[model samples]
Target: MAVEEILERLTRGVRDMDEELAAEAAQDALANQMPALTAINDGLVRGMNEAGRLYETQEYFVPELLLCSDAMYAGLGILSPHIQRAEEESRAKVVIGVMQGDTHDIGKNLVKLMLEVDGFEVFDLGRDVTPADFVAKVKETGAELLGMSTLMSTTMDAMGVAIRMLQQEGLREQTTVMIGGGPISQAFADLIGADGYAENATGAVREARRLLASRGAAVR
Candidate 1:
């Protein structure tokens, strides 16, 4: 199939929720004769954007969104290494994770994946992580940005704990904190003294980039 046709089919697969075809189309794009990066990146971002809209409107739940994300990943896996090498000098480094007691990681994982696609280096801490661990990772990695997730109201306090710990240890001045999750909000993020608050994955990337840029980070 022609590259245009393959990209068109990929778009249709995502719009129609044909998971199998979406995956296949991604692979075809990978193996196609011409430059695959532009087409695959466009299709991947478009599909993920559609999924984000579906999620925001409550038209699709987590499982379906996850599947669409999987399709995006199918394409992104091909692009990310190239994207990273394209910027081997460095784009940016980020530390991301879910807070302690928050075992859920869907939102956090999505943010990590999307950020990586955008060419930012990410260090994921998995789930059930403490504030000290987050701080330690930041200190060790020298990440430019720190992103945190808390899915439950009960664990929301952990975001503040992490932020305060940063301030206490003088890391706050060096690393910017970007916090989010179900219970997280702009007001609360301010209350916790986070550098930024993202309502969702895209916003997280945008905010993190903005904060890092303002701080004159390598990539903003």
Candidate 2:
């Protein structure tokens, strides 16, 4: 297929939530020597952006968004390994997790997916992550950003704890903190001394970019 045709197939596959088709299109793009970044940015990410728009307009709900992300990842799995090391290495590293005591991860997972599609190298810490673990991961990875999520109001304090841990570890200045999930608010984020707050996956991606830019961190 022509590059345009391949890109169209990749885009349509994500828009239609067809995992197999997205993967196939991604393979075709790779076989055609299309740049992996081009296929991702021009195809998968474009489709995910449309899905985000629909979600904001209420035309697509959580379920639909999840499916769309599935398609996006399907393409990503096929293309990401083929990306040039220099290009891949340029992506900013980000640490993400669900706060301790909270088992919910749907929101966190979505944010991770969006960040990956946007070219951020994400280290997902999974659910019920401890403040020490978050701090440890940041120290170990030297990540530029930390994103946390929790669905339970009771578990929200863990976000604050994690921040304090970062400060205590002397990593606070080096890392930008962002929080989200249904129970989290901008006011709450500010109160906890978080660097940023986002209500959803789309907003998280935007906030992450803004935070990185503010820190003079290079973002591809």
Give TM per candidate: 0.83, 0.95
TM-score of 2: 0.95
Error of 2 at 84 (Å): 2.4
Give one digit per residue, the lDDT tens place, for model 1 in 102-218. 899999998997787566879999999999999999999998899999889999998889988988888888898888999889999889898899888877877887888899878
lDDT of each: 0.79, 0.91
Q: Over the stretch 19-74, how does candidate 2's per-residue lDDT look in tens digits? A: 99999999999999999989998999888888888888889888988899899988
> Candidate 2, overall lDDT?
0.91
Regions of model 2 farther than 4 Å from truth: none
Cα-lDDT of candidate 1: 0.79
